[model samples]
Target: MSKEPLYSLRMRAAQGGAHEEGGLHISGGERLGFRDEIEALVSGLLRKALQHSRGDADFINLTIEKVEPASCRVLSPLPVSTYEVADAEEGRRQAAVLLRELSVSEQAIRNALCLLGSVNNLRGAVLLDSRSGERLDTRGERGIRVSRMDWDRERYLYWQNQHPLFGSPRIAEAIALATKVAYAPGTVAELCWSDDPEYVTGYVGSRRSGYCRITRLKEQGDFSGGRVFFVEPGTFISEYIVHLERTPVWIG
Candidate 1:
């Protein structure tokens, strides 16, 4: 019997003329066992991406790649400051403090946390108007999706040069995305909690504050996860997205 090829799927979608930076570019292959599973997963992902894109996406493309497992490079977790909390309530309290320290408005923090707590593991994030505390995501319940940082050549090259030091592909991508978006015009701050079932360490970040990991954002095994980006009141949504998809960032 032949061994199954390692299958991975990559996506790039954009509205109007953003091309490769269409604000949704992500890839996953990891432990997939069969080609059929890849097809099913990719189909579902594209559908979700389309819905979240609000019909402005001019195009969406899926790329399938097969590789040998031996070609992959494994690495340890990236070193970041961790704030341990005794329980979910404590975690929520600490998260509020961190977000406030980043100058995230009180109302915005309250709404963001509420959304995260109430929703299931969302594959995307919520965009909030910090000053008004209004939800800005186009899809409402579906939220808005952000990615494409791993596609930026400058950023990817930098990440590569750093090697096994940058951590898992998922976390590394998150950090890169957060750092780039932090500097984008009109952005205030970003928050994230992982959906990996047992993971409880989430982060609150801004251009000035950097990334701070907080444990117990939810109870272990709870599985709910999401992200939020708080922006200024008058920020143009399209322009803000343009920056997030097109700008290249370098981490020193």
Candidate 2:
């Protein structure tokens, strides 16, 4: 008998009437042997999307993809702090300290955290001008989508040799994107909190600081989360985006 394929689901919704284009409103997960559970999962997600969109979503998109497990490589867990916090508030304080250490300005860090807390979900990272602490629109409400970046077997193996935190494909992908953004010219730093309700650990990173993980960055069960990339003044957003989308980067 053939083994069950892994399933990935993503659902997003747009609010009705006049609304800002980039607030997340996205829900998704990956599973194994969930064929019989798809219908129920979709129904639950639809309810969430509409509710998060404020009861009247102008449109919603749901996508499901199945792939063999052998086709993907699992990566190692990321390097996390030795200390842990029991609650979100404590997590926030720790995160603040970490971001500050990375040289992220207080104002920019505050703005970034506010955006993540308010958005129902963000499909991509928001770009912020580090100096003024304001959002930088690269391509309208769509934010910077960090996808299409997967490491090949050889490259992945090479990374494994360099660092012990080179497991878990999902974590690796997140780090890869973080590294790309952090190293991009004019980028100051990055802040990210996941939208997964159960995930409370988030991270702050920069070319100088490397990646630092903080647990309890968000309230448990809080679905609002996203990423922010802080950039320097006079940054050529267009070129930065071109590099972000086209460049291949690896983390050690």
Candidate 3:
């Protein structure tokens, strides 16, 4: 028998209309801020249920009957006892294998799977041949780098206008600092904060990070990789680490 591929839960919002007070009225009139969250939750639950099932029938299919109140009705055509037995047996076997391979807890794996399923646009990860300097898609075909330079500039301008600290003086300083480095045409630079609110950093490289943080932006999946730019050590003298660690590493 062919090994079962890892399953992913897919969610569809119940199509319908809007209710009073500007509330969305899905099939069940369930109010949800984002559809992806519901998808993740459902996917996680199915994985959990399957883990407890004891059967050779290791699959659990779910259909969203209604969205307005977010209700799901599980569907299993096979006999419940047979399915449970097979699923539980397979689950234990898989759990043993997974435990040996993975260091993280089962919950973390489920959580990660849910997040992966919840993501609406994964922007397929590409591979760039470092030797030939060629950009290739997942299938090894030539790929194009999507340019968001203009959008980045616009966003920077908007942020500058909105923040008092990012006014003309700071903007000019930033521009001067940026000018020292030659940024490629498609390259995008952004000022972002680390997990800590107090730690702010500048990034100049590929579009992946920007694509993740900026909603309006879409990653072009540019595989045409290039050199990374960074200030040479001693370029700036400051108490903190003034120099960048390394050049751009090719992300395939």
Maximum-lDDT candidate: 2
List per-prediction Cα lDDT, in the order shown.
0.62, 0.64, 0.24
Candidate with the greatest TM-score versus the true structure:
2
- Please give, for residues 157-228, the per-residue lDDT of candidate 1 as tens digits: 665676555455556666666666676788888888865556677888777777677767888666467788
lDDT of model 1 at position 214: 76
Predicted candidate 1, C-alpha RMSD: 11.1
* Per-residue lDDT of model 3, residues 1-252, tens digit only: 112221222221211212222222111111111344456656554543333211111233344322221221111111101111133234333322332242323443343223222332221122222222222233221112111111123444654565544354322222322322223222222211111112122222222221111111112221121112222222221211111111111110
Q: What TM-score does model 3 achieve against the real structure? A: 0.15
What ranking of all candidate models by TM-score puts the best one first?
2, 1, 3
Q: List runs of model 3 lying over 4 Å from the truth.
A: 1-159, 168-200, 211-252
Residue 179, candidate 3: Cα error in Å is 9.8
Candidate 3 colliding pairs, count: 19
C-alpha RMSD by candidate, in order: 11.1, 8.1, 26.0
Candidate 1 vs 2: which has more TM-score: 2
Output the better candidate (1/2) by lDDT. 2
